[model samples]
Target: MATIAPSPPAALIDGFGRRISYLRLSVTDRCDLRCRYCMGEAMTFLPRSAVLTLEEMAAIADAFVARGVRRIRLTGGEPLVRRGIGELAARIGRHLATGALDELTLTTNATRLAEHAPALAAAGVRRINVSLDSLDPERFRAITRTGDLGQVLAGIAAARAVGMAVKINMVALKGVNEDEVGAMLRWCVAEGHDLTFIETMPLGVVDEDRTDRYLPLDGVRRDLIERFGLVADAHRTGGPARYLRVPGTATRVGFITPLTENFCDGCNRVRLTASGRLYMCLGHDDRVDLRAAWREGGRDALDAAIDEALALKPRAHGFRIEERDAAPAVARHMSATGG
Candidate 1:
């Protein structure tokens, strides 16, 4: 019989006294597709040598689990694109069996889920959030820049066929996909998948102006209520989304309004970049270099570094898109910070 280690005491309380229980761990800064809002077309990705090894990433995940982190979400420019991802997932997912981690989820573009869905399911991932901006083939191709819509749609279907719960994450862009959000909602209802609309955040310098692409989710929800008669649903998925269920259907729509409305008061999550840096806030650049800490001593170094990072976690991210051609909140792109 195997022996499970006892869970360690919680040590991730922020200055505001909020307990951090969620971690968005990025396995790679590379992606198969380059979405306009996320990164540039000619992106200069991180060298393979710069990223943390699979073993190191697993160790980091274990450290967080021991420190009262109940949920771990694998994020990325697209995590499925990472090499040996199946092995990495299974390693960290062992926490679920030990009861230290309550849930292990993934956020993906679904472009590679077709080939990796079964492997992910075997690794204890029951749910995934897919980034699907538009239902139209041409529009999707336009949004992703180089993505084939057929491939992604097939991937989503494959994931669902394997009993994986799917949640669609759509970033509301002012003239780009804003008009299609309603249509996407109706399609999500028919497909039996949850939909979430996110405001286009100013994270990095992209092709287009941030102010021009920004679309508030409040207006989107008001429009949704008018057309579909949406009602508030108390469904908590452990992220920063406020949900609303469509009447007479099993589908629930979510809104992630990072700019128009801040969710900092109850922010219970932090991001781990592929390079082993721990970011305390999504909209801020304050981070601790866990790579150096890990190299010096192991989990003890990581725990100490985490304490230093947590103590420095800001009360609120100073995000703003006040005007056109304005610089982003942080110079590092969302891809660098783990989408």
Candidate 2:
């Protein structure tokens, strides 16, 4: 095993008192589907030139890695929608190969993953997280305007075949696909996929009524346990999810209850929009633009923008209804900011 080196101290705080270590970068703001909750009527496309050039992104990433940001996850409306994404993956992987980056991964919708999974794996991406809300064809189409369940399934299989550590992500919306939760879990368990059931957040183009379907994760888990006899706290060691194992199976079910069980205090993430703005939190509005600084202000200016964003990181989201009311515009849409 490679010996892990100690992380050096870094002094940067966003307005919220959280140290920024993980940077989630968006390569494009465009997507193939208009997922009901994420992209509504249409998307306001960012200009081509506005998105960072590969070199520019690598520069910002380099600076962040230098300042203790060791985890990088490339995200987007759907990162694979962007042309030459695999090339970018290779570039980022090569940058990280220098021993600065501790983890590098991608979060994609997986519609185009089957075509790119092999390339991504060859580029050194050992981890992939695919957003797959439903296994039912009709329900999948209903959730994402034009996604093909067959294609998504193929993509997941392709990634696993390529030897990538795969994680299947699902967003649990109450009345819509809540009934199918058991089926999805059963499928994942049989397939040996690390499944995460995330609670629907009140961001993006979510319909107000969708909140009614926002099954608080606790009740969902309770029902599953009552039905399946879940053995609590049986999650794998060092696992991010708090999971429960089925009564007589090796498979485990995991939950990401952002609403009921907020993981904000341990949040080590920062987001970079497709247009190069750095967000300290999903609950923050204004962001520091590193791309603009790289163009006009140079390297020093770029570093300053990172420092500014990090110094403003919130200690905790303090996510409550009142907080949401106060920061009504704080929540950035999931697709554009990367869900």
lDDT of 1 by residue, 1-339 (tens): 999997665677988999999999999999999899989988998998899999999988888888889999999989999989999989988988989899999999999999999999999999999999998899898999988988988999999998999999999998898889889999999999999999888888888887888888888899999999999899998899999999999899999988889888989999999999999998888899998899898777879999999999999988888887999989998888886
Q: Residue-wise lDDT of candidate 2 within 95-207, one digit each (tens)?
A: 56788777778988899999999999887888788888888899899899898999988888899999987778888887888888888878877887767788766665444
Error of 1 at 199 (Å): 0.2
True-structure RMSD, every candidate: 2.7, 4.8
Clashing residue pairs in candidate 1 are none
Clashes of each: 0, 13
